[model samples]
Target: MITFYDILGIALAMSIDAFCVCICVGMKYNKPANYMRLGAAFGFFQFIMPVAGAYAGRLLMKYTGNIKYLAAAFLFYVAFHMFREAWKNKECKVYLSDPTVGVALLMLSLATSMDALGAGISLALWDGGIIWASCVIGIVCALMSFLGVFIGKRSRGYVGHYAEYFGAFILAVIGVRFVL
Candidate 1:
């Protein structure tokens, strides 16, 4: 059984990408209403993706016969990708004068929540409660994203990238924990 702390940790780890991207969104738009919109979009996707992934994972597990290692592998891949993106793009700039909405916002939400899909697969392998876990993930991500915008507005871009690195490290650690 997955403890609350474990679920919390996973939710936080999954929220990092959304938080970082929301920081960029906040920096770009710098409007309070935009923060809410972006947060909702991110939270919604973050919620839905895991449920979909968990269902898919259930199907895959039947064929694969035990997917804990596969889950760890996916986490590792996500971690490595996070590191690579952080290193490759030392700084990100968004030049739109207006807040992101519509298709662009949807794209952004989907991009950031991709890791949660992998996490959902792992959650299934571990026999965790998908509904509760996803709810927590969504709520936490929404709050983080809302805050990230404010933080980004006040600070420069350096912090957001480093946050991504930290997130990657957290995910790698979680993946290692699963393996052990």
Candidate 2:
């Protein structure tokens, strides 16, 4: 049986990616409405993708194992991208009024949260349902993303870059850990 602590751990770990991505999107976008939509999209996908992974794991193991590698690769890739973006010398104004940004945000959110999907596979293998886990992860990610966006919008200075770098480093370490 999954305890509340388990849920909290899973939620916090899963939400780290969302938190980092949300901050970047918030910095890149302007409309508050867009942030709301982005948050909802991230939360929804984070919730659903894990459940899907869990079900898929029940059907087979080879695919599930591949998912772990895929997720690790994605995390490292995104981490490096964030690092590069943050390190860039040019500063450009955000054109957030465009809805196309939402697609990009969605893709970023999905990429960063892929590890949680594989974790869900482990849960399914253990015969543990993801309902509780998903609820915790979804809610935590929504809130963390909201906070991250709000902070990014307000700070827009040294702190945001630091956070991005830190997230990227963490993702790199996690990816290496997964590979080894």
Candidate 3:
């Protein structure tokens, strides 16, 4: 069903934002538990945003069907940009070298998951079960984000560039598939 695919796609798309940010944050922290906390925070936000969006989306029925396409377009655009950056033979750089904890993490989580909020609106329009979709999104984001942080901490040298390119590629592919 469209709902299922939308839920899956939204989960993947939204998770990437948190994943990318979390990876950068991982570079700042030495303790492993910090990574877990970031992931959990991201997961929680990713989960909540959609449910809220879905509720709001239901109130605006006219725009529901179009959300997927919009999300896909946005994702593809991001992916292409990342891919271009990666393809360029430039030195890898860290954007947020000093990630904050607690309040900072909360801010980052909410900010990054904005897309998920939009997707949640779409999911609500599709009559997707909020509980199930939120849980899935939460779990998917938690796992991917945790992995991203782990990998970033471990491979501090060359992984950042690759992660961007890979994430971008994934977004583009998902977008193209949705458009098709």
Which predicted model would earn the best lDDT? 1
Tell me the whole-model lDDT of each prediction, alpha carbons only. Answer: 0.83, 0.63, 0.69
lDDT score, candidate 3: 0.69
Over 4 Å off in model 2, which ranges? 61-102, 125-128, 157-180
TM-score of each: 0.94, 0.63, 0.73
Model 3: how large is the Cα RMSD against the reference? 3.7
lDDT of 1 by residue, 45-98 (tens): 889888988888899999988888888898898889888888887775765755
The order of the candidates by TM-score, greatest first, is 1, 3, 2
Clashing pairs in 2: none
- Cand. 1 Cα-lDDT: 0.83
Where does candidate 3 have its weakest 10-residue lDDT segment?
A: 89-98
Local error of candidate 2 at 77, Å? 13
Candidate 3 per-residue lDDT over residues 1-180, each given as its tens digit: 345665676677667767766666666563678777877888998899888877776666565445666655655666676677557734433545445466777888888787677666556545547879999999889887888787667766355556556656666676676567
What digit string (tens of lDDT, one per residue) describes model 2 on residues 1-180?
A: 435664565566566666655555567563677567767777777788778867766666554444555555655775677678657623423444543254776676677568667656544534355776776677877887787677657765225445556656765665565566
